[model samples]
Target chain A: MEIYELTVHELLEKLDKKEITKEEILASYQNRINEKEKDVQAFVTITEQEAKEEIKQKANNPSKLAGIPIGIKDNICTKGVKTTCASKMLENFVAPYDATVMEKINEAGMVSFGKLNMDEFAMGGSTEHSYFKKTKNPWNLNKVPGGSSGGSAAAVAAGMVPWALGSDTGGSIRQPASFCGIVGLKPTYGLVSRFGLVAFASSLDQIGTLTKDVKDSALLLNVIAGHDEKDSTSADREKEDYTKALKNDVKGLKIGVPKEYFGDGINTEVKEAIEKVIEKYRQLGATVEECSLDVADYALATYYIIACAEASSNLGRFDGIRYGYRTKNYENLKDIYRNSRSEGFGAEVKRRIILGTYVLSSGYYDAYYKKAQQVRTLVKNEYAKNFAKYDVILTPTASNVAFDIGSKINDPLEMYLADLCTVPVNIAGLPGISVPCGLNSEGMPIGFQLIGKPFAESTILNAAYTYEQNTDFRKNKPEFKN
Target chain B: MQVSKEEILHIAKLANLNLKEEEVDTYMGHLEEILNFANIVNKAPIDGLEETIGVNEAYNVFRKDEIIESLNRDELLQNAPEAQEGMFKIPKVIN
Candidate 1:
């Protein structure tokens, strides 16, 4: 049997039935990586030997994901492993400790196959910002997979791994998952610990999972979620088995469809596909209601400002005097810091840092930065109010399917617009998931998003899984099977 | 809709970036478009409502202040680009 075609549950069943050993599964994936990695380029670093050893040890564990191979985004720190965030700034830097989520993953007995590629420091919507190499979409080799979490999404879509852990800030996880035709979930802000996940925008950042199906996403979330002493933002709440809520019943569930989402700029094909998905949900004992978000158009703008502001502060520690890249020849202290940052950071990162700094500067603080925060309250409140009436909000994961690589590199604002629908969820601190709905005329995958109330991920997963079961879109696999 | 080169340089210095002259025009164009688009936020009706900086409304996230041992010299210096005599060494600041 093709190992990549099996769901996480099916693979576990095979192992329980003595059909395969952890070593055999690891070997099969390693062989697949060797055969397909040259074309896919989904991973930044592959820890083949480490993966085999981990799986062998985990073979004795009782966890469901004990022997499953999962990919991790480069931004999440793994102790003694290089976590570069696909940027040149930390190319040689090795983390001294694993992020809280990574620690939990290890405890759960999941084998991390490798660190996947991503946009440099999760800045751009397209993976082209990566200083290492561009990650091609598994579906269409010439097209992009999606940004920030593009590599994680593409790897799962390409069958390189059954699941991957990705950080979502401003729709990074959901948008890429939509493009790659997989299920990606961005849990509520404090649902997952971010202690060791390299901070992008601390307030908006969340660790989520990308899987071939919704069940795997829920299972992975169940394993890596909960409060940790390391992260102050982690909520002190009880953990629930998210898988228990995936019965695919949406009776009397209120689904909101924002009017602004269906407006201009959305491709006709994507709109049609989403409409069909909505129709299916309606047919399956649910109600779809048309709602309006007053600040929908401003989501990208507010997201950029607030995210960059937080990033500028979070990245301040990476000076030459501290950890990360440093210039070899520096005459003075100022030169060391300046030259190190100039030589270390990429163009996109530098651009945002400059923008963030300017906005937070004394003169512009009141005009731009503070104003954005004040408005952010409105956006969050809007979601809070809407959640009172609806169980979830449904929208297209992206305005369009994956575009060709480098298409929006020159147009940064246009690229930022790609996360328009997904950013609002981040701003509101709500959980959102993207599930593959259909393929456009170009045969590229299109994802539909489900936004749920705070910590209401199970509702969203159940809805998406129910719709997925009713649809035939996920049956076709990419032609590049190893 | 256009941002001046002087403004760009000013923001850059504040943001701790040493940008090349050629990059200013690119940032200028992008920032202008973004700020113009951001005007939409001004129209949002959020006058009396309290501003939300974080999600879930769980507040009072203060930690108890207490003395804790700092990182050892070696561990601290491990992250430095250049350290000497158990401290970070840098070039002279004053002329």
Candidate 2:
């Protein structure tokens, strides 16, 4: 098999046995990226030279990620590397410092492959909103790879990279992972530091991993998950070795299936796929039962209000004064601010900003913003109650498989509904993983999610790992040549 | 839920954005749809629930006031659209 097809664990085994050198693996991936990047369009920047240079420097203490070439979603700052969040606003903006995750990756001697593409500031469900280019699903070139971490998911699924870093606010990581047919984990908010992530929605944003299988997700999490003094919201707690949770045992585990997640909007094939996953878990000694989560009905509305409010405030930094794109001509200071932002931001971003400003405006605050916050509390309480009864909750990652590109881009509301199944977990600050369950009749991949309590990444990872070990889903890869 | 072009422009101004005349009508329809969807929050049974500012059990995280070296001023200004004397330059605000 080609080196590009190997997972991080498989590559590490080869490296430890001296069967392959780090340079060989990097070169193999570079060759694969060169061959398939045109078809997938999964990258905004390819740092082949930088990656080659970094692998030459041997590490003093090698970690599990040593010598692995990993792609970072463009929103994460990478010091001198250009960190554009798939927006023209920061097209030429190069960060002066690395994000906390990048710092950890650098210390572990992982080769930074390049910056991947996403929706502008992670504001959309499909990468069709990206100012640069839309990433196609590796499973079918005509379909979307999902977004705003579309490039990251497509890169991993296409075997262009072993694993990649992605950030999730409202299903950015999991949805794409589901569409791309891979394992994606959005750790509990505050579990990973958000110090240098280009803030879309500060309260809900989290850095996560999109990988070929569940084990790679845990290994990557081990390297990147920790508290940073720089990010105040970062949890000040002991870091767990996530890799230790991969025992492939699910005996006596209680998994809850929220009926609200499988309501009217879900596709028939997606429902069947999730049912098969539940039956497999039951056969493995897990007690899977259907449960009702009432607050889920209000989660999408709550997410829009809260996420957009935070986004409007956080994105105010790009006003043409300090950094990012500025207008060519402006009569006065106010003109510069207004013109730059209007010219810099795309349609979806501007729409969200306007909505946010309206909701937070004087008379509307109590009616919308405050009301959403109260509903958010209700959602959190519901998840807390469910966790107390079940070890993990199982749901479909998305309502359906990957849709054709441009199908839902025109209607923003239709696009927002794609996040229906995954947003509630983010609302409650819980960890969730999307693992490939089966494929639809269209041959597109379908994923089922396993959500765990706050700081219970180990629980969800164990459940996913057990299910993955018992099935051949993880072994499936897209045939790019076809 | 009924958003006029004037309200759309007003909201755009508040957001510090400039919209073209043609874009205003598009935004009006989109915003109206979004607001109608956002109305779902009002129907939620949140009559007596406490408002949550954040999901984490957060408190004021404090640290000792210690000086830490930051990025070089020149490196920071490298991406500025307009920079002069290590400072970002914009149109004169006070006239």
Q: Which candidate number has the best lDDT?
A: 2
Instruction: Quote model 2's TM-score.
Output: 0.99
- Across residues A1-482, which tens digit of lDDT does each residue of candidate 1 receive? 68777778778888889997777777778888887788879999888779887776776788767778889999999876788899888887777778889888888888888899999999988899999999998888888889899999988888888889999999999999998888999999999999888989999999999988988888899998898867888888998999899997887889989889998979999999999988898999899989988777766778888899899888887777767888886787777777788888899998788778867878778777776787888888778788888998999999999999888998887888888899989998889999998888778899999999888888998998889888887776776422
Worst 10 residues of 2 chain A by lDDT: A58-67
Judged by DockQ cut-offs, is candidate 2 incorrect, acceptable, medium or high? high
List, for all models, the DockQ compared with the true complex. 0.59, 0.87
Error at A284, model 2, angstroms? 0.2
lDDT (Cα, tens digit) per residue for candidate 2, span A1-482: 88898989999999889999887898899998988999999999889788887777744445656778999999999998899999999999899999999999999888888999999999888788899999999999989999889999999998888899999999999999999999999999999999999999988999999999999999999989999999999998897889899989999999999998888899999998899999999999999999878877599988999999999899899998889998987899888889899899999999899888889988899999999999989999898888889999999999989998889988998898889989988998999999999888878999999999989999999999999999998878786533
Worst 10 residues of 2 chain B by lDDT: B86-95
Model 1: interface root-mean-square deviation in Å = 2.0
Q: List the residue pairs that clash in candidate 2.
A: none
lDDT of 2 by residue, B63-95 (tens): 889998877999988888889988888777776
